[model samples]
Target: MNDQTKGIIAWIIIGLIAGLVASLIVGGAGSIIGWLIAGLIGSVVGGFLAQRFDIKLNLGNPFFEQVIVSIVGAIIVLIIAQIIT
Candidate 1:
């Protein structure tokens, strides 16, 4: 696998984990695909919000940091989804 492939895989793993955790925390129902979608969306939104809000989280690990941000973002997405639907 190339660097891009590795990155994609890493992202998928992070997304899946973040989605699962977010769903559990925010209370959501869906399949693996749903979780993945939520996770990916959350990742983007979370990163953007983190930057916009100046949220600084130094977890000492890049991967863990990503997961934490992703989870927080996913929770936000889930909450919005719940309100919308």
Candidate 2:
């Protein structure tokens, strides 16, 4: 797949994983679809945070960057979810 396709898939996977993890940590009030949305948003937040912190995996592609970004994004989402609920 092309970089964009890979990136999209990567974000979806990351979103699902991150959402699941968040649900596990926080408990309930979440679904796969919700997590998916959270994950996508998280990636954007993660990217912003990563850029601010100068953190990068340097895998030489947006995919790696997105992966890193998603992890951060997941964490942010988790925290927000925890706080909101």
For each candidate, the alpha-carbon lDDT, in order, equals: 0.91, 0.72
Best by TM-score: 1
Give per-candidate clash totals.
Answer: 0, 1
RMSD per candidate (Å) reads 0.9, 3.2
lDDT, residue 6, model 1:
98
Error of 1 at 4 (Å): 0.3
Indicate the TM-score of model 2.
0.65
Give, for candidate 1, the lowest lDDT window spanning 10 residues.
Answer: 26-35
TM-score of each: 0.94, 0.65
Q: Distance (Å) between predicted and true CA of 12, model 2?
A: 1.3
